[model samples]
Target chain A: MTALLVSVIAAATPLLLAALGALLVEKVAVLNLGVEGMMLMGAIAGFAVAHSTGNLPLALLAAIAAGMALALLFAVLTLTLQANQTASGLALTIFGRGFSALVGAGYVGIAAPTLPRIAIPGLSDLPFVGPVLFGHDPLVYFALALVGAVAWFLYRTHAGLILRAIGDQHDAAHVLGYKVVRIRYAVVLFGGAMAGLAGAYMSLSYTPLWTQDMIAGRGWVALALVTFAAWRPFWVMIGAWLFGGIMYLALYMQALGVPVPTALLSALPYLGTIFVLVLISRDARRIRLHRPAMLGRPFSAGG
Target chain B: MLSLSPRGTASEFWRYAAPLLALALTALITGAIFAFMGRPPLLTVTTFLVTPLLAPGGWEALLVKAAPLVLMAVGLSIAYRANVWNIGAEGQYTLGALAAGGLALALPDAPGWAIYPALMLAGLLGGVAYASLVAWLRTSFNANEILTSLMLAYVAQYLLVYLVTGPWRDPDGFGFPQTALFSDAASGPRLVEGSNLHLGLIIAPLIALAAWLVLNRSVLGFQFRVFGQAPRAARFAGFNENRLIWLAMAISGGLAGLAGMFEVTGTQGQLTINLGPGYGFTAIIVGFLGRLNPLGVVPAGLLLALTYLGGDAAQMNLGLSSAITGIFQGILLFCLLGSDVLITHRLRWRVRA
Candidate 1:
């Protein structure tokens, strides 16, 4: 049971990070549907860098850079060029998948140095709770810390107020002299960085190797997590952990030789996402109150 | 600084010219990618765009490939026009094939005439049923169809995998994940003596024409247009949003299903795990490229089909990743969106204030 709990936390870490990033983007009224693509780019970039340089931090940085590059392209197209956010985002995902495949072709099957777990001295030695709480890679702790930081930044800061103002009413925020486009750009880039870090965690710690579509549909799941949280940071963590638990539970079922079909097990995450989305979106008032009003809308200063 | 200014009236000239311009831009960008990959750019570009058309029976093969895309895109264009997004046509297509192909395998002794038509109808019904889930969810529970439909697609894909690997696996063949070869009677007739092109080649255009008629000449089509262009006005005019959503999803899902049926009987000769190669997703691009008109989808489908064949050629000749097709497809969509912006807005040189 302790082992199962440990694996569940490991599984949830990447999702938690990605969801946190998406939460920031949502807070700024920018709906980026290309999180999957950005994650793919990060996976390959991280893998390639790790394989060549054998430097974990550099590889993670490279992954962040690759994700940011893709996010910048998306921002330019949807935010600056005023392209349809949905189509452009879908395009970004397609392009990122193909581009990542191209980049990671030679790196396939090459193993990279996995991150070492940080074991807290006394806490990690304390029986069942120790391994669950104190024995994890630094990324897991970083993810947890970042969540709290994000919660604080979003609720307790001046910049956070401005971001919420922009998201709640972009036109009004624009009239109030906030640089809507620039702020959105910054938040989107930050989101990309978090997503990239999440991808790095996948290649460097989760599985510790490069594979085609290694990120799978985690990016999409993270997008769903944002919606499932009703755009709240605290709920986003719980949602991510819940989904992470579901995924791990499926694996545990297969490992125990459960008669459930593997295909069905593979589909649990996506199905769970759909189910959660429905539950969250059922109340019109909840959606209207919580969802960023200017989300996915193209803004023009002159207008 | 360069800034975009909204036009009082969109330039009609750029509206038509944008796709052509985007096509050129995509070709140039993809050609550069080819060059980066250490392949001859011009040759690669020609291999993608020109070489396929030059080969013998290439046009026939192109038509065969385009049939599914055109069929699916026609439905998608109609739905998109109605402001309903059904991204899970892939799942609908899969269920359609399973429904139709399952019939053939289940009733091998049935007469061909009865089985084929019945299979097609079953396929169509399967698609409608699958898509109706999205309509029901959106109307009854207020779920976003995009995520729900997409999730359903993954579910359908897994379901197909399970069927092929389990109950549907052909017993007589060496252990392989595929159904039995469809009986000769159930197979679609070839359009020509030598080519693999099936009767679907004929049916695709006919469906496109019928769709065109409905979109242009029917009250339902007008409702679709009004809703897509102006949701508030559509509501004010008393058009039922829920009803329109159901209608759009049904039409799109039904056509996608028929496309899947044709693909199984016409192309594959049997259902397999790889029945769909993202045709459902690609058709979305085709719908947008064709200006969301059924008639326009015909040529748009052919152009996309050309890229698929070209991707195969580039893989063989240039040793490029088949993912190049996805890259080019994505580039085209991006370019299309960029060019489309110019239709309603004009770029001007503005000094930083």
Candidate 2:
């Protein structure tokens, strides 16, 4: 049971981090669909750095930087040049995939430098509950902390209110003398950094290796999670855990020598993503209330 | 400091020049990447762009790749114009192959004349079947088509893998994850005597031409345009939103499937795990590069097809990573998206913040 809990957390961390980042960007009414690409770039960068330097900290930083660089490109295209947000985001993801593959060619098959677990002395030595709660690496703790932080910043703070205001009505925010584009830029970068962190977690800890498309459709699943959670931060964690459980359930079923085909088992996560999205999106009123008004719509300051 | 200000009207000149600008910029950046990779920058870039054409049978090969890309892009352009983001053409393509391939395998003794039309029709229906799932979800449950379609893409890919590796594994072959070489009848009539180019090469452009007429001349096309530009206005005009969504997905999905069938019949000769070489995704770039114009997809597809050839050539000649092709494609797309900014806005000199 403890082992199952640990595995679930391992799978859920990356998704939660990515979805949380996307949640913030959505809160600001800017949808960056390049999460997959950014995560790939981050994965490659993180893997490369960690493999070479053996310094997990530097690797994490490189991963974050890689993701931020891609986000900056999205911001420049969608916010500065006023390009279509959907196209620009797609471009970012495509570019990230290509570039990551090219750069990571040399790093294939290399075992990544694993992230260290924080053994909190006596507390970590505790029985079943300790490994379930306190046995995770720093990233798991950081991800849980991030949820609280994101929720507080979004609900309790002045800046968060402004960000939500921009999401609800950017034109009104602009008339009120708020820098809509500038705020979006910052939010986008933060989102990128989080995606980067998630990518780093994948390479350095979760699976601990660099492979082409290692993120698979987790990036897309994370996007679905945002909708599943109704764009809320805490709900994102819950959704991530649920998705993680669903994803692992397939693998476990396969491990137990279930009668299902392996290919079908592998496809379960993606199919599950579609199912969850249908469930969440079936309620028209709920989505309308939670979805940012300007989501996927390009905002032009010049207008 | 430089800044951009809105233009009262979009720049007509840039609308035409942006692709050219993007091309030049792509070359420059990718060239720099070549240098960074420890290859001779100019020579490598030269080989990437020029070697494929210089290679014997290059033009034929280019057409072979371009035909299917243009076909899928034609459908995608229509969908995009309608503001329907059916990015899962790749999955639809896989289903088309599975459907067509299934029929081909079943009718071993089927006559050529009957088999060809049967395969083609099966491919079309197969794609429509997959795309309708996306359309139904969006129209009924209000699910985001982008996510559903993409998620389904993964499912379709897995299904293909399952068949090829498990059920469809070639019995005569030594444990390879491929179906038996499709019978001689399954291979469609070849167009070029020495190359793999087939009937689809001719069919793709004709379809694109037909699409051009429909998109430019038909009332349905006008509805697509209006819905894309202003959804509220379209709703006010009494357009059936659900119907438009269904039509858009069907058209794009059908074309994608046909392209898949062409790939198996024309080039692959049998269904295999390696059947889809990312043509579905590349067609997205083709659709955009052509300015989402059906007539424009032909040239744009040729250009993208060249990149695939160049990537192959560079891999063999320069010993550079074959991923260079993917990198080049990504950078080229970025430049195109970036340069498109000039079409609607002009850069101005700003002295002070």
Interface RMSD of 2: 0.8
Q: Using TM-score as the measure, which candidate wins?
A: 2
- Local accuracy of candidate 2 as per-residue lDDT tens digits, B1-353: 88877778889888778888998999999889888868788999889989999998899888999988999999999999999999999999999989999888888778888898889998899999999999999999999999999999999999998999888888887888889887768777777575797888999999999999888899999998899889999999999999999999999999999999988987888888877568888899899989999998899999999999999899898787777777788888888988998988778898895
Candidate 1 residue lDDT tens string, A28-69: 889888888888888888888988898988988998998898
Tell me how far the alpha carbon of residue A14 in candidate 2 is from the true structure, in angstroms, after superposition: 0.6
Q: Which pairs clash (backbone N, Cα, C closer than 3 Å) in model 2?
A: none
Q: Candidate 2, residue B192: CA error in Å? A: 2.5
Off by over 4 Å in 1: B349-353
**Native contacts recovered, in order, as a fraction for each?**
0.73, 0.85
Q: What is the lDDT of residue B96 in candidate 1?
A: 89
- Docking class for model 1 is medium
DockQ of each: 0.77, 0.86
lDDT of 1: 0.88
Alpha-carbon deviation at B69 in model 2, angstroms: 1.0
Query: What clash pairs does model 1 have?
Result: none
